[model samples]
Target: MSQPQPDPEAPVLRAEGLYAAYDGTQVLCDVNLSVGVGAMLGIIGPNGSGKSTLLRCFAGTLKPTAGRVLLFDTDVATIPVRQRARLVAVVPQHTTTSFAFTVWDTVAMGRHAHLGLMQALTERDIRAVSSALEQTDCIHLADRLITELSGGELQRVIIARALAQEPQVLLLDEPTSHLDINHQLDIAALLGALNADRRLTVLWVTHDLNLASEFCERIVLLSNGHVAADGDPLEVITQRQLAAVYNTELTVMTNPLSGRPQVVITASKNEARR
Candidate 1:
């Protein structure tokens, strides 16, 4: 694969004064953010904070009522859908397959943006698919039916599909929401390692503050469609911030291994009295 041509000085993706609404109900309000090349950024917020809307705008799948999204300085809306698909890939929250396609077959679908209609795939396409499978550690499941795979397996296959696109920027919406604890950690570790090796920019949307603290270098906390805090996890995931945004009680502590901030929900007994 050729080296990515990303501007180190400029953000790979930027949102300027983003605003969106449905039937006059505003969702995102004047949200402005930037994602640096080769950096992993996590977007965290309570429900209805417009996390998914922001991603959809970036993906060029949802047009905003206001604001503009730029990809490497060019407006996302100006780029053709097929061309944009090559530059960015989104791993949505929900994934389902009915045809029972083999893992390889499904992953190869990501290369459609690069091929002409009905055109035969070249050696390049096959190599890309193979590399993606190996990258996501799904090579063992290459020939397995997607329908028969477990949730964790299916998630990796979806990631492999995105990898096959060879995008410079990857946007994931709640990638770990449906997985068990072990799989969640596995996915987080995989993303960390992949980001280190490929230098692909990642924008991960998640509700788990601890996971974001462990994996992402920087995080943006959103509340009521605006940026509440944007900085290192230690700074953003504080007790005050969580209480304010989530409107709940919690405890924040330092992680011994990473030295980043970790959160714990305090438990109290109804019959116990201080």
Candidate 2:
């Protein structure tokens, strides 16, 4: 079966005039974001800045109080539940299983969208799961119970599940938030490789500005539910932008190897003022 080839000029994912609220309080206000096919865009912001909220809207997991989310020319809200799953997959900040399930069985769940009720895993499903395990380097943990895995291990398993969906777009929320340095780099390299190899459109939400700057092709900085800046990392991750949004003394420097900007929180201005 041939998949729909995304238009080069058009964005694979788009958020137009998005406004979301929780308990009568707005979380995302008039947010607009667009990402082309094979592009990796990072959404960065401080806590309560609505980065995750925006991602949830794009994933169709949360309905915006107002405005529409469009995924490849089709309104996400209009797509049926199962069909939508095949088009986009989301890896949330935290995923847990109440009961222990084998890694292989968990990854196989991603194929549910393509299967009928109670249908057995098809040959195609096996191939997809195997490929996902290899890409995530979790093939060794196939028989391990999810309850026995560490945070980093679980994160990779979750991503593998998302990859098994064969989605055109991947939505990630703070994927590296709880990971150690090595695991963080591992996930970043994996995402970069997949994006380059399969032309996967990715929108990732992150609090780590330096990591986002290094991997993301475009960065959208949000402040208090509004888009503060949108451009390349060099344009958005500046000292002035970080200070103003985070209320901290920040130092922005160039990475000699990649020539990308890196942000550093240099001082505790809040403590100094207090």
Candidate 3:
């Protein structure tokens, strides 16, 4: 049977009254959100605020106990795993492999979704992998072992693997969490470019408020398993909202270069006197 054609007019992804629990402990409650086609949305919140959990639900790796996730107006749970992999790709916070796999081989794994059982990589699959590597600037490292790459290089390789899937939507959980400032900026810029050039629907969970503010077209702030704020960076990433959710003393200021909100941590009076 032919797969259901996506409704172009519908939101690319939507969660309705989502509820999830892990080990019988509720993590998400009544979460509702919609991601439009080609949108770049960032999910931000304090640790344990269900940011990753929500992302897992959307990725179909974790089934919600209640409610549903819709991809192009069709239920995500009903889609076959391979079909879903073709439409959405996920980049987790960390990737590990004990065996020595070349960067090219690791990236080529993404083509499994498109291949039949025991099938070899076709010309199209090879092209996709090569394109992904090139797009992520990882082509130079194709012959290197994934275990030998730096954190930044490894992260880019992981993203390249995802891009090899040719997914319409990308779901990432803290893609830059382990990188240094420079690498973080590099990854962010790469994602921004992909979003603009390919119109890829990007939804990522991040703790870096400033990164989210600077890069995301929209931000959703989760607090206590609920959406505390959802809007453009300026509107959702305010000092008031962050202070309340983060329970910390911080200031939100406009970046001189980007005009986006930049979060600044403020020292307490006791610390200031030291």
lDDT of the structure predicted as candidate 1: 0.89
Residue-pair clashes per candidate, as listed? 0, 0, 0
- lDDT at 98 for candidate 1? 81
Clashes of 1: 0
Worst 10 residues of 1 by lDDT: 265-274
Clashing pairs in 3: none
Q: What is the C-alpha RMSD of each candidate to the true structure, in Å?
A: 3.8, 3.8, 4.9
lDDT of each: 0.89, 0.90, 0.91
Error of 3 at 20 (Å): 0.4
The stretch of ten residues in a row with the least summed lDDT in candidate 2 is 1-10
Candidate topping lDDT? 3
Per-residue lDDT tens digits for candidate 2, residues 1-274, read 0234345588888889999999999999999877789888889999999999999899998998998899988889998989999999999998977889999999999999989998999999999999999999999999999999999999999999999998999999999999999999888888888887888998889888888999988899999999999988889989999899988876899998988998765446446766
Candidate 1's displacement at residue 116, Å, is 0.6
Model 3 regions more than 4 Å off = 1-9, 269-274
Q: What's model 1's TM-score?
A: 0.94
TM-score on alpha carbons, each prediction: 0.94, 0.95, 0.95
